[model samples]
Target: MSAREPSYFAKCACGKFCAELYGEPFLMGGANCYCNDCVAACYYCDDKARKEGKTNISMRCADYQGAGAAISCWLLDNLRITSGKDQLRGFKMSAKSPLCRTYTACCCTPMIYIGQKFAPRWRAFNLNCVTRASDGQPLKPTEMSNVMGDFALKEAWDQIPAGQPKYKMIPWGLFPKVLAVIFLPFLFPGSTVKVLEEDRAVPGMFIDAAMVTEVVSAETYVAAGVRVPKALLEDKKGK
Candidate 1:
């Protein structure tokens, strides 16, 4: 299942940066994560944009904050920075944190997140930044709850859809599911399946997360006007 053309197109708010995204969304495993990091990152991007006087870069920042989760598509092994890769910048929550969030330097549009969990193999694109589908229709792929219900802000937690399952952390079963998605093509090679090709992956950004100056932390989120969840605050205090 190789797509000669891009299935989705993602661009920064500034329109200076763009990427061609390929892969089936369902096969990629989309999810909504309610973890503190995910929530804080959204607030951080919004705050950064405001400070720089960059307008119209919202990309659902408030909506994600209000909904208490960040939805992402686990785009594994098929990404191409079509233009403005030089403007790509990223940051980590801390020196030790495995998560690295990349954004466009021009307008601070939060783009992709690659954590140690995904590592050299996968990248999760923020659903907000993915603005267009090749089909010219709205992009709506089914998603499952991924993690951290306890860290959602009170109001945000209340906004979760009824009957949607919430987890305090990533469920153990998630590992197997992820593994299956990654290896299925190799297990049964056929026209119906597609194995990820490193050669077609993102060529490389202007800078890796290591070079990004700012480090996000609890204090940083607070300074950015993000309301930390009471449960998260309590958990940190306990530690």
Candidate 2:
């Protein structure tokens, strides 16, 4: 990192997930997502692991980590995975949902939410998975959690920060896109479903974990990508 460029540390459970999120500190806005899409994304990795029957570590970092888990993040592209990039995987909550629910292939640690079609400027980091920086400070901590989605548990809504920004749903820009998807079929009967053009898998990607033989250590994990201080070790030291 350059003298002028500031950075913060974050990682997933069992040392399988970690990264130095680069950007202006606290420049990214924060929100608590109660959206089903966000919730589904949080569980996507776990669901995939079960379906694929791949060998993996215990479910430690786990799901979104219950209520009040607001994700504070920068743009999705800003996250530089320091290790276990192969473990990283993401899926759309729904075909029309904008957020690419991202997480690690090693375990179901809810990581970042990326945009596939829209809202490319923002990256939603799972606040639940963000660990402390080497300095023992939070990275892009949220001012408040934004409660979104048409349906959310009433108990979950009660956990919103007393003084932070809380939204009933997503930003105003999303309404039009959602409406179009909702009404497109009705407006034009027999219209085909819209799919992302870049959904095809690219070359050099391993289809299964058994295909990879390289040993991955959490310690080597940190230095593999962006540089982070020695003070912040993997969340689970020897797991």
The best candidate by lDDT is 1
lDDT of each: 0.59, 0.47
**Could you tell me the lDDT of residue 222 within candidate 2?**
31
Candidate 1 local lDDT, 159-223, one digit each (tens): 77688766676666667776776676567666222333532222222234454556666775565
* Candidate 2, lDDT over the whole model: 0.47
TM-score of each: 0.71, 0.53
- What CA RMSD would candidate 2 show? 14.2
TM-score of 2: 0.53
